[model samples]
Target: MSAAQLVLDLALTVRHDGRGGVADDLEDAEGLTAWVAAHTAELAEAAALPDPLAPFTADPAALTAVRDLRRAVRTLFARAVRPAPPSPADAERLLPADEALDRLAAAAARVPVAPRLTWPEPGPAELTYRPAAPAPPVDLLVSGLARAAAAFLASDDRDRLRACHAPRCVRYFLKEHPRQEWCKPSCGNRARVARHQRRHRADAL
Candidate 1:
């Protein structure tokens, strides 16, 4: 995944539970491990994270750090959407904007980065900065997530970020088109059903 996508996906980890409530994918070690496995390859490639000899396992501390970053990310996503409601998972208790920004900045700073020059046999030379030697898997992951969030927020795509408010769904998504409403067809269907139910109840009244 591109860095932009990582931030959005991280914020969306808090989503609709099958039983109609909020569920957090980072609630425990198992869930966090699974989520990282699923997204790690793409993100690692994008961020130049080191490949591990054994599969990466998330520990309690990693879980706390990642969840902390997610809160900040969600808070910023809420701010990006302006007057529109944010995803309901933590809408009522989002971190303060300044705090959220600080969290992201701190996570990204955990790893030291230095600029290096690169030249290809067939390409022109370019100067680029790579993250210095690998940190612990969890630290690198969190730092990468924070960096991705910062990049996304500073890019044009941030303007398209939005919260999905369909029944039982709490997600943030990009606006694909002018008429796009919910995050997907299913959410749109649910929203229509909800609208219909509201109208029917109103008519009976």
Candidate 2:
């Protein structure tokens, strides 16, 4: 997946609390822990973690940190989706996210990485890349997520970021097509059905 999509997806794992006006899954540590575990493989790949560490341990502090980061990301996206220009208050509200991002960036920079040659299907051409050594699980996860979000926001692809329009689907998606509205077909159906029902009610009235 594209970095923009990955960042948006991470923000979305909490779901239901944005424009959708639904329940929050990351309301507590347990929920956050489950989210981390569910997305472990992807997170591992993004962090460039070795296979032996297939699943990262989800501790309480990590859960708290992740949930907090997710909230900041969501807030930033929310502001981006708003019709009006962001006021100073909006910037003030994003203080936590800003601070967290700075810290994560610093932590990521401090981590030591080694350059390694990688081959695709044992081909003649080898790719050289620097990969981080195993570090604190929380640090790795947070830095990776923050960097992804930072890069996405800084890229032109940020223009494609959109919040799902379905009534109860609190998802932010990278709009794949020009005409796509909802994040998925189920959400589109829900929105259409609701619109149809609303039309019926208007007719009855």
Candidate 3:
């Protein structure tokens, strides 16, 4: 997936109220590890890192750090999607993006990158690329996710970012279609149903 999509995917793992609510998937290190394991393929493809499983650091502290970064990214994306300023409480979270990016840059610096030539697809498909030395898995993961966010934030598509407004929803989606408002058909239906219920209540009062 593209960097934007990657970051978006990471930001979307846990629901808006997921930390302590019913949909919280990153509530603990175990859950966070599971989530990382599940996305190994996607993460590997995006980062071009060797050994897809290598990026999942076994350190408990690393797991906690990634979880923290994920939440920080989600907070940034949520703000980007909003039409107005976030509440003062929400505004407090705006600093995460910077911090996460700084951490990623530091982690990335330690990877010791060098340019190398290789033939990717047999005949006549030679290309040069910068390859990095083996480093802690968490570092690569952080760098990849941070790059995704940085790319997305710098792109024009950031304006198209939207958070599902459906009741009890916390998913973020890119506006693929001009008429696309909700993330999925179910959310649209739920939103319509909610509107109808509100109208009915107001009419009967």
TM-score of 2: 0.70
Segments in model 1 whose C-alpha atoms lie over 4 Å from true places: 124-128
Better structure of 1 and 2 per TM-score: 1
lDDT winner, 2 or 3: 3
Q: Give the best candidate by lDDT.
A: 1
Q: After superposition, how far is residue 126 of candidate 2 from its true place, in Å?
A: 8.0
Pairs clashing within candidate 2: none
> Scored by Cα lDDT, where does model 2 land?
0.65
Ranking by TM-score: 1, 3, 2
Clashing pairs in 3: none
Q: Which RMSD values do the candidates have, in order?
A: 1.8, 4.8, 3.8
Tens-digit lDDT track for model 3 on 151-196?
A: 6777898887887767666677788999998888988998899999
- Candidate 3 has a TM-score of 0.77
Total backbone collisions for each predicted model: 0, 0, 0
Q: Candidate 3, residue 64: CA error in Å?
A: 1.7
- What is the TM-score of candidate 1? 0.92
- TM-score for each of the candidates: 0.92, 0.70, 0.77
Better of 1 and 3 by lDDT: 1
